[model samples]
Target: MTNQSNNSVKKTVLVTGAAGFIGFHLAKKLLSEGHSVIGLDNINDYYDINLKYARLLELGIEKNEAETYNNLCNSKTHNSFSFIKMNIEDREALPILFKNQDIHIVCNLAAQAGVRYSIENPEAYVDSNVTGFLNILECCRHHNIKHLVYASSSSVYGLNKKIPFSTDDNVDNPISLYAATKKSNELMAHTYSHLFKIPTTGLRFFTVYGPWGRPDMALFLFTDAISKNKPIKVFNNGQMERDFTYVDDIVEGVTRIINKETAERIQSNKFYKIYNIGNNNSVKLLDFIKEIEINMGKEAEKLMLPMQPGDVERTWANVDDLIKDYDYRPNTSIKNGVKNFVQWYNKYYNS
Candidate 1:
């Protein structure tokens, strides 16, 4: 763990889901610090492959060159970065990856993301989020990885009806399969930390929106529809609220915790911990829409819709622990975040 603060050590970091938004950014940051980085992903056409490729390109990995089937690595790279097109669900391939690389830190961000999608694709969620995560914990435990940081979600605090959800809140009542899987991840990590002494941190992310965001997220959906002069659906009759943490803020918070490992035993103390990485600022759906409108300088054709299943009425993370532990600060205002997102959207899509 000497490499924790020593930049000269240049430890290799494994970023699962490197082609994904958060993973891409975190990998790039590690590379910039002169640490060798291995970016792992199945590169499944879950969303637009182009967006994933664009993120890789930013990391100096080209898509045409990154072509690979299951259990194969494209071997594409920057001087400090390498990408492998491997799914975490492939337990066989996962341990091989951990054994082959001198991976000092492992960031598990590759789970099947999205709440509503999990409802329709329950099998995929269990496979990627549950089975896949077990594979990660197993690999990390055996590989002697220094720290394992994984993505948890605010959705796990389902039906709590609490303002600014806290880590102390009971999260056994997850409404969505996705939420349940994420909660399961935290539990699983805690077990490993207790049994095997594998230091782990699970981050409960709120609604993360920003430049180069996911296509399925509301930020992307609203921007796309408004720009095309199409009506955008407002779920829950525009009554929904979210603590939309900007991607930059989330990445910064993740980076802060990625280097440090909690060493206390779970039984003796809080060896495994979960922190809420959120904006700590909630905005109503209509207000969010208006912000997008202001940023895009285009009014959206409103399509007020009922509350969608598996969707929460509100999410606001109480980030006091984050601030107390790591001095976490989220600076992007909705107006500013939306503007940056809109700029990226127009530039990326040539709108």
Candidate 2:
């Protein structure tokens, strides 16, 4: 049975990695759409715990309450939203939460995210992306989850020289551990969808950015360094390109997939699918930096450097499947997107 609100079916969604960039935006979007949300995150110090706590505060969960483990904290602003401070790898506790929450949908966005960082700390990727994802699949297999949507990365395309990477392209040669883990997730999701008959969809997000974005991303890094009169690292000697999709656009695609009727998405006798969620236009790295400089009203000191290990030179996502299936339209241009991020950075850090 499903709850109906505001001419839409209101679902109880369990969104893991609720403190992360895409997760936070997705959670806010879900709440505004009248869905009941149960947010889960360990709030790891991958970048800054303060930023994570700040995002939670926006969702009406206090910092003091967000710090406690395994304790459910209800939202003060939205009665339909609640949060739990926990890791997905907590195999024992995760299942119990699934049993109690009556979650109709599961969106697993919780995973160790950096490509270079995965090379330095490989275990973190295995723990969170592999083992933790296994737990999510187990819960879905046991519990009658209506649909499971999870995050995959464009890095999974690895060293593919193919332009406009598509789901039909071969992804067997992931260069980094992070990419390998995400590819493994696609395989795992496929397995569960085939064996257990669980409907699952995975999104391959390409260079997501915008307000409340991760500090480690290029937009934030460049903005902060330029504002501080410091040099920004220009990788691949400023010869790279990325399909930098805005956060709101990515969230829109996600919400569409979440709310889509399961009966309409089956493919090849299996209820599994994968789509690329991206701007569909790859902008040059230097051009992206130029846009940031334009927004910040300052020039960036570029420290031209060789491409780092485990990093791809360019990423261009082919989002044709997303467009065909969900009417996913990523229309945010790099200019407006960078302007929005710069405005947010100035307000968030200066004020």
Candidate 3:
């Protein structure tokens, strides 16, 4: 890590899944803060490849250059930001990239996301989330990376009736393959931390939403359906509840964890830590939709439906640990968050 100022250290950070929703935001934030960021993503067609490409465009990597696999494309917008078209599961390529890049820290955000999709494509989950994560761990172990910050999901609290999910909660009984994989990540991170003494922090994010959000998430889907006069599926008869954290808040928590000295926070010889990053307040599903309706100036034709398979009823994260350690809590209200997304959505689609 190179000292940029008395208060900040500039690091060469490897941000995998850089084309993904949260990863894109984190990479941009890191670059703005004077860090050298290497953004990597396979650009898999899990959703819209164009959206991923558009995100890369925001980072100044042209679509033509971004499409080339195993090649590093320097950003035209930010000199400190570079992107590579690669998969973390590529055991051969990942190590070489690490060796060549001299990455001081790694924030592994690449994973096969979507809970329901995991059921339809179980093998995809194993390949990306399990095998791919193992490759990242191996690279970190060999390269002596200063810190590893990985994304964990709120779905890991599967089947737990607890209102506010805590890091101390028993997450052994995961309902979905997606949840199982995220739980597996936490366990894997713990093992690496314990064995190799790698300082690893896993952030279990809850219902992240805002600009450049995933098209599959409820906010994006609902906003799209409502705008198009299509019926939005209200699962569990709109009885769901979520923490509904904003993207900016999630990025803030991640950057703080990344910049903080790993040794200062870890316990005696224990280099593993996990924190739930959320809004710290759960909002009712119907109310959340109403906020979207207000922002979009259109009401959604909701198709009240039964709960889908592999879906949990509610998720409320206990972010006390994050507040205690970083003196930060996700404060973005759903009202403002929804409005921001709607504004971005209208502008993005209109343009």
TM agreement with the true structure for every prediction? 0.94, 0.96, 0.96
Among all windows of 10 consecutive residues in model 1, the one with the lowest summed lDDT is 1-10
**Candidate 3, 15-62: lDDT as tens digits:** 999999999999988988889999889999999999999998998888
At residue 133, candidate 2 shows an lDDT of: 99
Clashing pairs in 1: none
Residue-wise lDDT of candidate 1 within 165-191, one digit each (tens)? 999999999999999999999999999
How many Å off is the CA of 9 in candidate 2? 0.7
Model 2 lDDT per residue over 160-191, tens place: 99898989999999999999999999999999
**Candidate 3 residue pairs in clash (backbone atoms < 3 Å):** none
lDDT of each: 0.85, 0.89, 0.89
- 1 versus 3: better lDDT goes to: 3
TM-score, predicted candidate 2 vs. hidden true structure: 0.96
User: If candidate 3 were superposed on the true structure by all CA atoms, what would the RMSD be?
Assistant: 2.9
